[model samples]
Target: MPSEGRTFIEEARRSQIIECAVDVLATEGYARASMARIAQRAGISTGVISYHFGGKQQLLEAVVSEVAKTATDLMMPRILAQTTATGMLRAYFESNLDFMRLHRKPLLALVEVVTYNRGEDDRAPGPYAEQHETSINDVIKLLDRGKSTGEFRDFDSRSMAIAIRGAVDAVPARLLHDPALDLDALAGEFVTLFTLATRRQP
Candidate 1:
């Protein structure tokens, strides 16, 4: 019982520290955000963060995981609610972009972490690369479903998927540069363009 209590408290503390790390990363920039700063923000000792996460890289990974989970949570319900493939595609991108708008700070922090956090080998964000592949595969699945239903024209689904993902992925930088960027307008525009491009001939 005592061990269970300790485990629960440890999890709670780890959650708090990760939350504070996201806040610090967004506000301070990735290069400037240190574990000590995150600890200060969380009102905990730096040793506690180190004990749980080991280092900055691990903490950044945790932040990325949290942000991705949040995005999936926002996107999956909307995607599942749609019966049509076109509807699912729109739901996937629009809801995802909407999630970005709603959770700008955390998403931006994720961008910073992915763009700036380098490993010893100086590779690109390992998690972003993996997640991008997963996203593209999901888009391909939607395209294939639409094709199977005779709703979409027979085109290269992988190309389309990559294009759509590229457009959506570019939004974070745009929003950062122009805070007043209209994401819904962008979302509607992209969905309409793709729908027209992919729809079967009358």
Candidate 2:
């Protein structure tokens, strides 16, 4: 029970640090979000961060992972609940936007980390990049499902998926610039735009 209690406290501290890191990353950009800054935000020492994550790169990876997991947990259910390809597509956009709207800080942090953070070898893509590739692949599968079912017109699934991903991703930067932008309306526009693009013409 003592070991279990220690593990719980450690997890709690890690979560707190991750949350602070998200805030720092969102506001300061990844390059400026040092361990000291995050530690200050968390009211803990930098050594604590190092003890938990070893370094900034690992902590940034954890930030991406935690945010992505939260988004997936929020979104996958809505996407999975849909019975039709069109419904799934609409849910995909709506749920993604919903998550972004509700969790702007985490999304912003994710954007900054994925956009600017790099690994030891500058040429190699990082974990966040790999996660994005996985998301694109998932969208391709969804598009293929729609095409197979005749719910969507004939088009290159990869191309359409990439377009959709780009549209969704461009939102965070937009929000960064215009915090008052109506994401609900924007989400509606996206659903309509992609629906028109993919749906079979009457």
Q: How accurate is candidate 2 locally (lDDT)?
A: 0.91
For model 1, the superposed segments whose C-alpha errors exceed 4 Å read 1-6
Question: Candidate 1, residues 1-202: lDDT per residue as tens digits?
Answer: 3233468778788789888988988889887788888999999888888898888777877788888889999999999999999899889879988998899989889888777766545754555666778889989999999999999999999999999888888898888899899888999998998899889998
Q: Could you report the Cα RMSD, in angstroms, for every candidate shown?
A: 2.8, 2.7
| TM-score of every candidate relative to the true structure | 0.91, 0.90
Give a tens-digit lDDT track for model 2, residues 1-202. Answer: 3233468789889899999999998889888899999999999999999999899888988898899999999999999999999999999999999999889889989988878877767887786987898899999999999999989999999999999999999988888889999989998999999999999877
lDDT of each: 0.86, 0.91
Residue 172 displacement (Å), model 1 = 0.7
